[model samples]
Target: MATTSLVPSSADDPLAYRPIALVDLLDRVLGTGVVVTGDITISIADVDLVYLSLRALISSVGALTPPEPPGGAG
Candidate 1:
């Protein structure tokens, strides 16, 4: 049997869509958040049967710290 990696490739990698850094995630979830609102409606036989709605708010980690100066405190 041929060996294969469990990690998804670039084409279908799920992690690729998710945040990889905690700080980055926090920053977006608290500072610059994203608001998502959606609704799905399904009907069969000319009658509505299924309906779905979703809403969420994501924020980033408030303010980010400034980078320190380089050159060992010149």
Candidate 2:
């Protein structure tokens, strides 16, 4: 069976994209991580989604670290 996209194709479609923060985006999803070369032809689109999600997770985790105070700064 052939399935057609529901998206109404238009020039504005490209402009409707979004850039979400790495941590806020990754919180809901579950996974480790994976990297690949650009030349690879497999599931390139989904890869971007995961990559962005991972970045957000890392960023959020980084912000959670406690900073040391002066003197001992522990």
Candidate 3:
């Protein structure tokens, strides 16, 4: 069996394809933040038996920090 990749191979497009490490990818995602949402449903005989909804926000702690008050430091 053969699998297909969505990303273009480096051999096919060296300039356009640059593989990123998993750690680097995660770092970028966390720095910028991301929202993920999904829904799942299971049905039997056209009747819905189970349903699931999920939502999540991922970001680094520094990215979530609130700005300082409008005043000089104490």
Candidate 4:
């Protein structure tokens, strides 16, 4: 009898399991820009007591800046 693996090995796939450092992850996230949204609710005896909603964009200054006008500066 023979057994087979369900997941591809890193050697078999170039895009497979590569570890990224925290700094690298942050750089990529900021470079591409990301949106985070969440909601929180607190209830007592099925009665809602508090609720919160949040939305945020995380990115680098360069990524958020708009491009200059078509022609160069006036």
| Candidate with best TM-score | 4
Question: What TM-score would each prediction reach against the true structure?
Answer: 0.38, 0.20, 0.60, 0.65
Q: Which digits, one per residue and each the tens of the lDDT, describe model 3 over residues 1-74? A: 99988888778886876779999999998988999999999999999999999999999988888767788556
Give per-residue CA lDDT, model 1, range 1-74, as digits (tens). 99997766777865565437997776656775688899998999989899999998765334344556886657
Q: For candidate 2, what is the lDDT?
A: 0.49
Question: Compared with the true structure, what per-residue lDDT tens digits does model 4 show for residues 1-74?
Answer: 99988787888898887789999999899998999999999999999999999999999999988888988788
Q: What is the lDDT of residue 61 in candidate 2?
A: 40
Off by over 4 Å in 1: 1-30, 61-74
Taking all chains together, the TM-score of candidate 2 against the true structure is 0.20
By TM-score, rank the candidates, best first.
Answer: 4, 3, 1, 2
Q: What lDDT does the true structure give each of the candidates?
A: 0.71, 0.49, 0.89, 0.92
Clashes of each: 11, 3, 0, 0
Give the higher-TM-score candidate: 3 or 4. Answer: 4
* Stronger candidate by TM-score (2 vs 3): 3
In TM-score terms, candidate 4 sits at: 0.65
* Minimal lDDT window, size 10, model 2: 49-58
Q: For each candidate, C-alpha RMSD in Å?
A: 9.0, 13.6, 5.8, 3.9
- Stretches > 4 Å off in candidate 4: 1-18, 69-71
Residues forming the 10-long window of minimal summed lDDT in candidate 3: 65-74
Ordered from best to worst lDDT, the candidate numbers read 4, 3, 1, 2
